[model samples]
Target: MQPTILITGATGGIGIALARLLKDHAQLVLLGRNPQKLTSLQTEFPEARTEALPLTDAQAVQALIETLPALDAVVHCAGEVVLSSIQDSQLEDWESMYQSNVLTALVLTQQALPQLRASRGKVVFVNSGAGLRASPGWGGYAASKFALKALADALRQEEPLISVTTVYPGRTATDMQKQVRDMEHAEYQPEKYVRAEDVAQAIKTVLDMQRPSVIEELSIRPG
Candidate 1:
């Protein structure tokens, strides 16, 4: 049987690209919030199973993971990037960013630990380059990603059998960028951004690593 990979934020962006790329390699268990998008992807990946839920909801996230039998991998691709200066960043916006980038990953990882332990599975975090250091306007988004990186590192130490990989991707051509550019008046040109498919391919390579080998961290930036 093909190994199963549970992918969060499967509606679009790198998540959608990864699902399409890995469809042949793994049985995909897609998770997302939008019913229409979930149904659409389910039709596209007819062989894969799907769960539609807002992952920030702790109970919903836990229940969704509990329903899975055994997973070979879990990819936390669900995240949000909000660019606001520290002084102007609203508390609510920071919380929202944390919910999307940090809490969602935490909730899913915590619940998926048992199945991952059972199979010695992999946990791949789709982090951001902003995670590594501070950027002026990236206070909220960067902070959340930094927290995610710390969590992934700690988890790797605790669960040596279950490999952990964190991917730091630079600006990507996705709806998330569109929202930022549109709402914040930032000049985010999608044409200049990295192709989502590239990130998906990188993730596939990480997943195909041999046993006893782990890609602890990887960074992908567009030239």
Candidate 2:
């Protein structure tokens, strides 16, 4: 049987690209906040299951997990990026980033633990370069990603049967990157950033790894 892979942020640029790559080979469960986009993706990949809901809702995520069959992998792509310097950042901005980037992954992973353990599955986190090193005017977003890295580390240690891979991609060419550039009044040059398809391909490679051979972390930057 083909592996069942669950993808969060299924409507986003990287999420959509990754889904397109895996849909033909895997049983997919696409989760996102937009009902219309989820429906559209479901329509496009008729064999896949789609859920339109907030990933941060613990109860909702648990309920959704209960409905799923055994899963072979989960790709967490849902996150937020709010650019602000430490001095100028508001508590609300930090809170929002924490909830979206960190809490969502935590809750979803916790809820899916049972199924994952059963399959000796893989967990992939699509993190940012900021998680490794924070740059100027990116304090809030970077802090949240740092927490996500910590979470991934803890999960890897706690779940010995499951494989965990954290990918840090530098400035991917996505709508979110455009928003970040607009916030900084910088030039929005998609060519300068990593392509979403490249990130997806890296993920595919990691998922293809066999037991006793695992990639713990991967960092990808634009050429």
Candidate 3:
């Protein structure tokens, strides 16, 4: 049987790119917040299962996980980026970033632990370079991603049965990046950033590694 893989943020650029690559290699379970996008992706890949629900809704996420069969891997690509300096950032912005970037991943991974352990599954977190270092206008976003990095590290240590890989990619050409650029009042240049498909390829490499030798962290930067 093909390995069953779950991808969060299925509607986003990197997530969608990953889906297109993995469709033939695995049985996909695509989860995203947008119903229309999920339906669109489902139509494109009829063999894959699709779920449209807010990742922050813990109970709903748990329920969804309970219905799935043995899972072979989970690729966490859901995240949010808000640009605000420490003095300018509001509590609401911090909360929103935390909920989207860290809390959702925590809740979903906790819910999927059983299935993952049973299959010795791999967990790939699509992190950002912001998680590594904070910039002038990225305080809240960086904090959330830092928390996510911590979670990934803790999970790697605690869950020996499941391999965990955290990927930190530099600026990517995605809608989210466009939003970030708008917030920064910088020019939106897609060509200068990394391609979402390239990041997806890096994730594919992580999942394809040989047993007993796992990549704990992967950092990708545009050339």
Question: Candidate 2 regions off by >4 Å?
Answer: none
> For each candidate, C-alpha RMSD in Å?
1.4, 0.9, 0.9
- Kindly indicate the candidate among 1 and 3 with the higher lDDT: 3
- Those runs of model 1 whose alpha carbons end farther than 4 Å from true positions after fitting are none
lDDT of 2 by residue, 108-134 (tens): 999999999999999999999999998
Task: Report how far off residue 207 is in candidate 3 (Å).
Answer: 0.8
Error of 2 at 82 (Å): 0.9
| Model 2 worst lDDT run, 10 consecutive residues | 49-58
lDDT against true structure, model 1: 0.89
Candidate 1: deviation at residue 24, Å?
A: 1.3
Per lDDT, what order, best first? 2, 3, 1
- Give a tens-digit lDDT track for model 3, residues 68-176: 8779999999988878879888999999989999989998999899999999999999999999999898889999999999999999999999999999999999999
lDDT of every model, 2 decimals:
0.89, 0.93, 0.92
TM-score per candidate, chains pooled:
0.95, 0.98, 0.98
